[model samples]
Target: MSKKIISVIVALIFILNSIPVFAWTPAESLTSSSVVLMDTVRGQVLFEKNAYKHLSPSVMCKLMTALVTIEKTDLNAKVTISKNAASFNGLNLVVGNQYTVEDLLYAVMLSQGNDAAVALAEYVGDGDIKKFVRYMNTEAKELSLKDTYFVNPTGLYEKAQYTSANDIALLIKAAISNNTFNVIFGARGFGWLNGNNSSILTNQNTLFWSYKGVDGGKLGTNTNPQSFSAVTTASQNDKRLIAVVFNTSKESAFSETAKLFDYGFSKFYTGVLVPKNISQRSIEVDNVKLDLSSKIDVYYTYPVGDSFIKNISFIPNEKLKLPVNTETIAGVLKYTLNDNTVIEVNLYSDKTVSAPEDYRTKIKEIVTENRDLVTIVGILGIIEIILIIKNLIKFMLRAKKTRTQQ
Candidate 1:
């Protein structure tokens, strides 16, 4: 072969080799075994990989612990640390120390204090650790988490104490709904002072350092399974994203979470599936027409350049009864994507349609409707009566005249 032909062949081989062999998939660049990205506002999953795989959440369980504590007890209440709680090796809490619930919560979130977890659990559970664990499981069930079960409040590596990446993301969403929890979670660091000593507690979640728009998150690491997990929330352009990564190295957890955030923000955006003022049309029921109420805007987070509005269908309720009251629900607008119902909203009537009037009222209505025709008929009847009377008077006068002539 000529030199030019060989050069062309070599160049083609290099280009082919550079192309990826497998089709592109989400979280492909991450080392985590399970990952999920969720749009909190729309409650939609933007990306996932084995998101339901059950694994030990380790210290990440503190999220639930903090949530249960904050919800069930007053933050200003003081908690006396117990010996069992202080025995946890990594925590700096002292036995018999008294700290406010708010202080312990900050310690648990910012410092990842297992001791604080125990103290809060004990205080919230009224000194029963088992009861607190049961509360955790109950809350998990209430959230409809199928792949989660908490064996302890501290998430101290019980084989049965496991949760999925998706469940953690869901729990985070619920946790953030509370203003108190949300504020605590977002804190970067806090000052600490007790009777004996004072120290600073810093947030361990590395996303605050590496990623922009990092609002809050939790981190976990366990040696039993050699797993690391992280859940983080970030916001940009008036949109917020929650990302969870499980069963990865400590360093990879934050990195993978950032990767998920990047994917979500770059590929997806909030769009209106159903616009406000969706319909100006009227619906007829029982010969009575009624106008529709103003429509509500339904939003969804979807892939860029994809249109979901076209797939929306407005279907009036077939079983609508007569005499529909104003602002009553008369139908539903359903939005379906890929043969699945994504969003649905009730449609209401703007005006009432009263039932038909009674027979007497109906007769009066008919007369009023044909007033011109009734007036013409009345005039013709009066003229006929006058003619009859005139004929009768003429007959009587002729009869009298004939008798007199005879």
Candidate 2:
């Protein structure tokens, strides 16, 4: 081939190679069997795919185990490892070895140590493994997770132990809220020495290396069921999100979670549903005026270009009685999207209203104090005068009739 022709061919190849071989679509691109992306600040789901499907959570259950341990036992407390705990696969925790709860927590969170999980559970459960699992179930119930159950502290492949992607996201949200859990979950690596034995823990969450704004995460895998799962959290541009993926390959877990976080941060954001220092207004009850309290600093997450701010309606409680006390709930501020209620916040009275009475002196004083009260007082005064004149005329007519009968 001629030199010019060869150059042209090479250029064509370069252009074709630069073109995308596949289009990216979140719903179709993900490889996980189940996935969920949530706005942690607003507790709203940004994306989901079979999110409720039951699957073996594998080691992701350690998050709950860590949470229970953090709550039940002090971090500085010393825990003696038992034979059962030491027998846990993966970590080489020696039987009768002693380690601080805090050190073991790092292992459980960052290193994915099954032995550490059992040790923490034993300490928190008072040496009863079954009781520790019960505590995990109790927490799941308290979180209102309908599809989660725990048969062990370590997320081993138990036939009866299973959780959904949605439930795992919820669990992570609850776990990361704690300062201790958050710190350990985000650590890239932690190291310590226990009686001449050097122990080091390192995070397996690849998103920390591959993505930005990754705060914390957990990974789980099981060969018996051939399952892989991951839960991750990230914050960007004032928005925080949690993502979970299950039944995926180890590599796909990180990539899929990154895609979910990208979708969430790019497509959703927190918006003010009600602005702070909203103008205070008044409601009239039984001819008495009660001032409504202002709503301040309320927000919710929504699609990037869509907003519920304009759709919010402040509806005062119609049944509020006169003489409403200050700070009493008098109404609700309803936030609606597509005509469906999304949030309802209670409205309270800013100031109390006294009982309504036709005291002329009080009315005169109110009218003098507020120009707006004049019209109301004037109409009431006219009505009172008309009723008084009608009574007087009836009395005169009755007296005249009595005189005529005499």
Candidate 3:
């Protein structure tokens, strides 16, 4: 075969043999109800089964209520029980008993008391239950919880009380961010304010005892949906993850969560930032070279399967058309399985920068001009070497002629 034809055939063969990676899918049973396991580092869903499906969050909604309450009120503040606040169909605070906001949180969350939820809400909302409900729904919207709608602070059987597993996960993520809230969630029990009786608020989540590195979370139940969800954080070695599981039978919730947790730890890995102190490099802006790179403490949030090392693909713009500014979000780090189950980690500037007047056009023009200059310089360098060699020969010949004359 001709050399040209042989080269073309080899190139075609290489292209044909390469196959795209496949994504990992969940087993059949897990698909019936929604399930989502995310790596907090990359914020990527490691395994999702009907992740967007809407279902009642049950008492898991308390996680959000607890968060809102924590935001508005101090734990040490005094809570005065009202007629309605103390008298709920399930889990009542004694009609006249006074408690601190912290104690009420334990009752509402650990004891799963609807009355406690109301009492705390009234205290935080300044005796307005409707306004508290408004806060709940508004905050849900702020979190971009598409299918979540809260009718009451307590996750009771209400007409519009519903949330997806994904929505609950977001709520849990927000709650765990607060250090005080984290301590509340993890505690096995709390003391009473009136010195009524020290109630040991055992976590309904059996997984807390069974699972290794299990930080405490919330659990919920209702008749229509025999559901329970908990936000758990577990650690093995130095790697840790926050996992949330929503809407499974009470009998099955703990076991299934264990299964999910085990599946996550066994199938995936959390890695530390490579080269620990390595910072992101800056991109060039118009004429003025500005350093936009951030010192990111990044860890891979994905399952590494059996192989401890995983590949993260950082895809920058093929051409830098986006303006470099502090607020501008550019590029993404995509972590995936051998098969393409993709999750994105964002790249942001560590410091602020101002774009040149003609931002978009200037960026495009600069990239094109820079690339052209580099190519021109590379070619000129080769030509310059050849010219230097010719000049050196001419100088040597002149020196030899002078020697001959001497």
On lDDT, the leading prediction is 1
Candidate 1 deviant stretches above 4 angstroms:
1-27, 280-282, 291-295, 308-315, 338-341, 359-406
What TM-score would each prediction reach against the true structure?
Answer: 0.78, 0.77, 0.67
Worst 10 residues of 2 by lDDT: 273-282
Preferred candidate (TM-score higher): 2 or 3: 2
Model 2 steric clash pairs? none
lDDT of 1 by residue, 1-406 (tens): 9999999999999999999876335645766788889888755788888989878867557889999998999999989989989888455788787999999999888775888898898899889999999999999999888889988877788887888888988888888999999999998888898666777878888888889999987777766778777878999988889998885477878877887887888888887665665564478898777666446776778777876444766788788877688567787767666414377777778766677789997988888999998889889999999999999999999999999999
Q: List, residue by residue over 101-218, the lDDT tens digit for candidate 3.
A: 8877887777677888888878777788888888888888887888888888877777677887767766666667788888888876666544555556677767677888777666
Full-model lDDT for every candidate: 0.81, 0.80, 0.68
- The residue-by-residue lDDT of candidate 2 on 1-406, one tens digit each, is 8999999999999999999876345797787888999877656777889989888867657888888888888999999989999888756788887999998888888866899899988898898989999999999999888899999987888898888888888877777788888888788788966567776667888888889999888788765678778888898988789988875488888888888887878777787766644544567888776666545677778776777344767788877887788667788777666424377767677666766667896867777788767878778999999999999999999999999999
RMSD in angstroms, all models? 10.0, 10.7, 19.6
The lDDT-based order of candidates, best leading, equals 1, 2, 3
- Please say which candidate is ahead in TM-score: 1 or 3: 1
Candidate 3 has which clashing residue pairs, if any?
22-339, 22-340, 268-303, 269-304
